[model samples]
Target: MLHATISGNVVTQSTTATNHSILAFLTSTIGQISPARIRVDNNTVINNSTSGSTRGILVDTPDTSTSPSFDATVTNNSVAIGDSINGVSGLVAQARKASETCTSLSGNTVTFPNGTPSGIQGLRARQADTAVYDLQTSVSCTGTAATVLSCLNPSATTEVLGTINTVSPGTCLLPVTP
Candidate 1:
C-alpha cells in the first residue's frame, strides 16, 4: 500500500501475506515527502517464498539531497521465509541521504528454514545505519546446512551501528531504539 499523504497509521493483528514477490511486509517508498508515523505490530508474515528478494518490513526513502526522516515502529511480529530464496532480508530501513531518524524494529522474530548463499540480512539500515542499530532476536539460520546456514553476513555499508545477531535457531530478532 502507498502512503502518499497518509500518516499516523497503525497496522496491527494482520495475517501472513500471500504476495511474497514484493519487497516487504510493510513498505513505504515515499520520495521527498516523509509520511507520518506508521506502526506495524502483532502481525504474522509467513510462507514468503518468492524467488526474488523478499523482505519482512521495509521503510525506504529514495536517495535525495537531504534525508527524508521517517517514523516507523515494527514490533512483536512473526516472520518466516522459505529456503532457497535470494536477497532475503528480515528488516530493512533505507535512508540514503543524511540525518534521517526515528525508525525502530523490535521484538520481531524472523526465520529462514531454507538457506541461500545470496545472504540473509536480519536487520539492515542503509545510509542511516549506525552503531545505535542492532538486531535483537533477529538473524537465525535454520535447517542445519553449513553452506546455507551461515548468518554471519557482514555489513557492506560503513554506518552500521548495531550488532547483527549472527547466531542460530529461535533467536531471530531486530531492534532500533531511538
Candidate 2:
C-alpha cells in the first residue's frame, strides 16, 4: 500500500470493515504499510486467535530519506478476542526518523472476552510524537460480561466485570491535532 491514490501533492489510502466477523483467524498481520495519508474505518474482527502471535493493523513506512508520512487514520474498528492470544496488537505504528509523523488512531474498540493475554496491547505507537496518533477513542472491555471470562475462584458467588479503558489525549506527545 504505497500511496496509490495520489493526485499531485496530495496522497491517500483507505480501507473499511463493515458488518463482518473474523473467526478462527490465523494471520500475523491484517493491514500493513499503506503509504502516507491512509484510512481504515468501520470494521469488525471477532473470535480471532493465534499461537501467541498476531497483529491486527500495522501503519508504517520504510522511506527514511523523504519527508514524513502524514494523515494516516484508523477509526471505528472492533476486535473480539478468542483464547490466549499473546503479544497481539490491535493497532501499531512506527516512525523511526526525526521528521516522521504518525497521523491518527481513533474510535477503534477492542473487546477481550477473557481479558487480554499477557503482553498484548489494544493499541500502540512507536518512535513518533504521540500527538500524531489518536488513541483516545479506542477502548477495551474486559471482565465477566465479556464473551469469555475467567475467575480466580470458579465457585465465587459474585463476579465483577472489568471497566472500559480509554486513552487520554495528553498522555501521548505534545498536544497537537492531526
Candidate 3:
C-alpha cells in the first residue's frame, strides 16, 4: 500500500496463538518497488495469551532494497501483553532494508502483567540496514508492573531517540515510567 491511515480501533487476542494482532507493512517482490506511508494512532491492543511469542502492534518494511521507502507514524496507542514463553512485544517498528525508513512513535502506553518473564519488550524500534533509518519516540510507558528498560530491545543497530520517562533498569537510552 502506498498510503494508509489506521486509527481508533480496538484489537484483542485471547488465545495461545503467536502472531501480530495489528500489523501494517509494505513489502516488495524482487525488483518491485513498494513505498509506503502509514499512520497508526489511537488504537487499543490487548493480548491475553498464555503461551508463544506475539506482538500487539507491528509496523515494518521488510524489503531490503533502496527502491522501497517507508514512513510511519504511530501515536496514542495502548497495548497490553500477557504471559508468554518467548519474546512478546507490545509495539514494534522495524526497517529491515537499505532504504529510507522513518518511524515516529509518541504518546503510547504498554502494560505487562506482574512477574512477566524475560524477553518481553514494551516498545521496540529496529533498523537492520545501512540506510537512512530514523526512529523517534516520546512519552511511552510500560505501566508499573514491569521495568521499562528491561522491556526494550537492545540492539546495536537500534536507537530510541526522544523524551521518555524512566521507571526501571537494563540498557536503554530513554526509559518509560508508569
Candidate 4:
C-alpha cells in the first residue's frame, strides 16, 4: 500500500502466541516500486497475555532487492502490558534493507505491570541498510514500568531526532515528560 491512515481505535489482545496489536509491513511483492506511507495514531492497545513475544505496535520493511521505501508515523498511542515471561515490546519500527526508511514517534505512553520480566522494551528502532534510516521522537513520549528498558536495541543506522534522557545504569534512553 502506498498510503494508509489508522487512527482512533482501541485494540486488545489476549493470547499466548506471538502477536502484534497494530502491525504494518511494506513488502516488495507484486512489483511495488514506490514508497509506502503509513500513519498510526491515537489508539489504545492492551496486551493481556503473560507469555509470548507480543507487541503493541510494529512497522516493518523487509530486506529484499526490490524493496520499497517506507515512511511511518506513530503518535499519541497508549499501550499497556499485563505481564511478560519473555521479551516484549510496546512499539517497534524496523527497516531491514530498504533504500530509505523514516519513522517518527511522538506523544506515546506505555505501561507494564509491576514485577514484569526483564528485557521488556518500551520503544525500539532498528535499521540494517546502507541507505538513510531516520527515527525521530518528540519529548512527549513516556514509559512506566518497574523493570523495563524504555528504549532498547537501536542500530547504528537509526538516527534519533529528539532530546534523549537516560536513566540510571546508562543503558537506555527514556523520554522526559514535558
Candidate 5:
C-alpha cells in the first residue's frame, strides 16, 4: 500500500511476504525534516521492476530543498528473482552495451572489481567518501571476457571489468533558506 502521506517522525514497520514492490522516493524536498527517520526491512526491489527512470528506493527530486535525512534500514530483500520472466528491463536499450569516454575519469583512479589494491584504504570508510558499487553482467566482452562480478569472484578467470563505478555530482542546486 502506498502511503497517503508520511509526516515528520514516522515510525513504519511492515512485514510483506508478497512479491509486489514498494517505491518511496525520498528527496531533499520531501519534508521539512532535515533527517527523516526511515526504517525499511524485508522487501523485494528489482531494479528493472522498481524502476521508472531510477532504481530501488531512490532518493530523488520531488522535493529538492527539504533536506530530509534518509536513514534507510533495508535488510533481507530479494532483488534478482526473475524466475520466469524474460527480458524484463521494460525499456529497451538500443544496444546491449553502454559506453562513454569520460575525460574526467582519467586521474580518478579505479578500484579493480571487488579486489582492493595493496596499501589502499579498506571498504569501511565514511559514507560521505566511501563508495558502494556492484558490477553486473554486460555483454561487452570478448570470448574470454566474462562480467566484472564474474571475474571479480576469482573463480571466473579473466572477466572483463567495467570502470570503477563513480558518481560525480551532476549540476544541481538545492535552495537554501536563510
Candidate 6:
C-alpha cells in the first residue's frame, strides 16, 4: 500500500474545504507523495469551481508536510487556466497567437541578436544552414562569372560588389538593364 493514488476527470465544487489533496497526494520516503510518472496526456483537470481560493491542480504538500513531500510527473495537461467571466478554469490553449504577432504591418523589421531580417529569409541564412545553402539552393551571379562565384572570376562582368568607406550606400550603385 505504498504511493497509493487515483486518476480520472475530478470535478471539485467544494466551497468550504481544507486539508484536502484532490486527485492525488502520493509520496515515498517518510510519507511523501511521489508518483513514478504521472502521464496526464490529453486530459483536463479543473478543480475548485466554486471559488478562486482553491487550487485547480496542485502537486504540492500539506501544511504539516516535510521535505521531499510531494514530487509528481505531469505531462500534457492544462490546469488552473480559466476565463475572465466566471474566474473558473477554461481552455486548453492559454494565450492568443494573434496578440503575439507584430510583423504583419509593413516597415516592421524584427532583428535577431546580430540584426537579422525575420521570417523565412532570416532562418535561411543563419550560417549554420550552410548545408541548405550549398545543397538545396544556389544563386549564380550570371554575366560575369564563368565559374561558381563571380568575384573570383576576374573576367566575369557580374559581381557581388562591396563599397569603400565614406560611401553613402546609394553612391555605390550599379547599372541596370532595360
- In terms of lDDT, the best-performing candidate is 3
Per-candidate clash tally:
9, 2, 0, 0, 6, 9
Per-residue CA lDDT of model 5 for 1-178, tens digit only, reads 1122221221221222222234444444333444332333344343322222222222222333343333322222223212122212111101011111110101011122323223322111011112122122223311221332232233211112223332232211122222
Per-residue lDDT value at 116 in model 2: 65
- Using lDDT as the yardstick, the better of models 4 and 6 is 4
Question: What TM-score would every model get versus the actual structure?
Answer: 0.50, 0.47, 0.69, 0.69, 0.29, 0.30
Task: Please estimate how well model 4 matches the true structure, expressed as its whole-model Cα lDDT.
Answer: 0.60
Model 3 per-residue lDDT tens digits across residues 1-178? 4667788999888777677888976677666666777788899988876665678888867655545666677777888777645546678777666555665566677777544557555777665655455544224535321233333322211224233233222211221222
TM-score of 5: 0.29
Between candidates 1 and 6, name the one with more favorable TM-score.
1
Error of 2 at 175 (Å): 22
Better of 1 and 6 by lDDT: 1
User: Per-residue lDDT tens digits of candidate 1, residues 63-172?
Assistant: 44443444555555555555454546665655444434354445556656575335555555544433122222233423322221223222221123233222233222
Q: Write the per-residue lDDT of candidate 2 for residues 80-152, one digit (tens) a residue.
A: 5454545355554445432334334445566566766676656555444221322222124223222111121
Model 3 TM-score is 0.69
Tens-digit lDDT track for model 6 on 38-116?
2222334433343433434343222232222211222233333221222321211010111110000001111122222
Model 4, C-alpha of 100: deviation from truth (Å): 1.7
Task: In model 6, state the lDDT of residue 77.
Answer: 36
Error of 2 at 121 (Å): 1.6
Q: State in Å the error of residue 10, model 1.
A: 15
Q: For each candidate, C-alpha RMSD in Å?
A: 10.5, 13.2, 9.3, 9.3, 15.7, 24.8
